[model samples]
Target chain A: MNLSELLDNRDGQVYRLLFYDCRPLLQHILANYNINDSQREYDCIMDFYLYLRGDEEPFAMLTAIKSEKALPSWLKTVFSRFMARRANHDGQTDYSDSAFDKIPDDEEDSRIFTISDLNTAITLIEQINTSYSAPERVIFFADIDALASNRHSTDEIISVLHCTEGNLRVMRHRLKKRVQQTLAKLTTND
Target chain B: MTDTLIYKYAYNQCTPDERRAVRDMLVSDFSECFAVVGLMKTRAVNDIESSMLKAPALALAVSPKERRKTLEKGRRGLPDVDACKNAPAPKALPDIAYDEEMAEMSEPIMIKEQAFGMSMYFDEMPLQPAPDFLGILNRYLQSE
Candidate 1:
């Protein structure tokens, strides 16, 4: 849907929800990415809001909004694709056939995080921690931190990190796998 | 679980079962849960000493100009600092409690009284009572 159309249809609920819920989710994402400066994060959030609403040119706006000199290539690509899809829906111009037709077959299998998806994961993690043993809780925390840090190597993760090898291996084999599966399920639903 | 237990759990100081019970209570009765949370938050803020609770932006609410004027006026209108410092502290409110509804309704009447007092500053003359012209006529009628 067009930005205006979405706003009109949702009657400000979208903006309210974005500020109330999605802003905190974005903050969490930024924290995971090690972007801790509050002002920079605030600007990035405002930039994202303006970009989504079609108020500014996409790439130029992103450059002005982000404090970093260059964003990760993967992030830039994802953002561009998101913008292109939004532009197309907004009826500004159609994406090239090449752009429209190229779907990543891997996306069907890969996990992506959405705001609600992350909230549910957090809730489940809390529940598990409440019900689990102390060692199990430590394992859960390690796995969650590992996931947030984007470090997927189980063996390297075990040795370099402080937790016992057995616990780390169990966490990697079982807990991490469960988290990934949960994330995949959420992505599919989204 | 009780509200006190829920408040403790909210602060992450409760046992696992207590935490679970608190969470279950919150999930079922969210409004009451949030009220407990709100009270905890208020107490937390209050526990921080005033000097330690400074936020620079919030200080702008009382402008420097207004602050200076207030100080100057206090100097001129009020008693000397040493005398005021030596004076006994004001008495606390008497140890009496009223119904909640009466307390709530009392505020507006107090506010009206304050407003009436403020109006005297704008008006120079003191308020006078209305003349009673009918008193003489009533006296004459009674004599007849």
Candidate 2:
């Protein structure tokens, strides 16, 4: 059936269809979090479900959507917002908890960071270097540089840094964790 | 995402840091670049469709590809993303954060400066006409 028909469902079949169609995307989002408790996980899912199904605004937004293919990405943002809201409600302050800490500010999607904010984040990231040879600073700046120039290559990075694939993986994981910590600090300090 | 935010992002009208943050999201998060692109596409298509609906004759005159190109080019008043990387460091504006609230509050006061100033002459002196008047008139008439 077309998106219009799916959207016109009166028996809540739309949510069911959406849930199944976007299950993999939702599952992928959830997998990043470290929610160990089954009950909390279920609660998060149920809350997100209610958010989508109960809100008139979300439904209204859905009406403007022309393609079913776009729904997954649009819903991805919705699910992301819900996750941020859940994290905020939980009152979790520690950045070491899980992947949820990656998104420290619930309003990050809409937040406009200034150059000063980027500089501050960069400084904090640079400070997190565990060793002189560590590639966090290089990698972070490299990625940002790449964003502008559209020239990022893993092979180039490895060759320049004289690091192996295994070492690069470990360093990236470390850098990711540090970046999360820096992001959390930024939100709190602001 | 808010319409303004989506529009700014899709049309490259947001600040450098704002663009960087969104790009960082794509890189650091769940590889949702494709999905994010889809979302942006939805917003863009809605805008294009609405404009086409408003002017069916104009829409018929322009091919879809040409219309899309015009939309992207016209709406993007800023430099391209590649140019942004190489552009000189932006001289810092006032320290106030450019949040949504600030945007709303400042909207009334944010007057754009004219690119050219009015001609200067003595009050008693007759106004000397500019050499480029005919060119300017032609350009203005063509735009209309």
Q: How would you encode candidate 1's per-residue C-alpha lDDT over A60-137 as one tens digit per residue?
A: 433443322222232344344544564456522112445323423354444433323223433444443333322233
Evaluated on the second chain alone, the candidates' TM-scores are: 0.31, 0.30
**Docking quality level of the chain pair in candidate 1:** incorrect
Best by lDDT: 2
Taking the tens digit of each residue's C-alpha lDDT, what string does model 2 give over B15-96?
5565566556533441233233333333222221221012112111223454355445443221132332343432322211
| Alpha-carbon RMSD, each predicted model | 29.9, 26.1
**Candidate 1: tens digits of C-alpha lDDT, residues B15-106:** 55665676665555433322332333322222111111112122123234533554454322211333323444323321111111122232
lDDT of 2 by residue, A57-105 (tens): 6776667777545565677777777787777787332323354335443
- Model 2 compared with the native: what TM-score? 0.25
Model 2 chain A scores worst on lDDT over the 10 consecutive residues at: A125-134
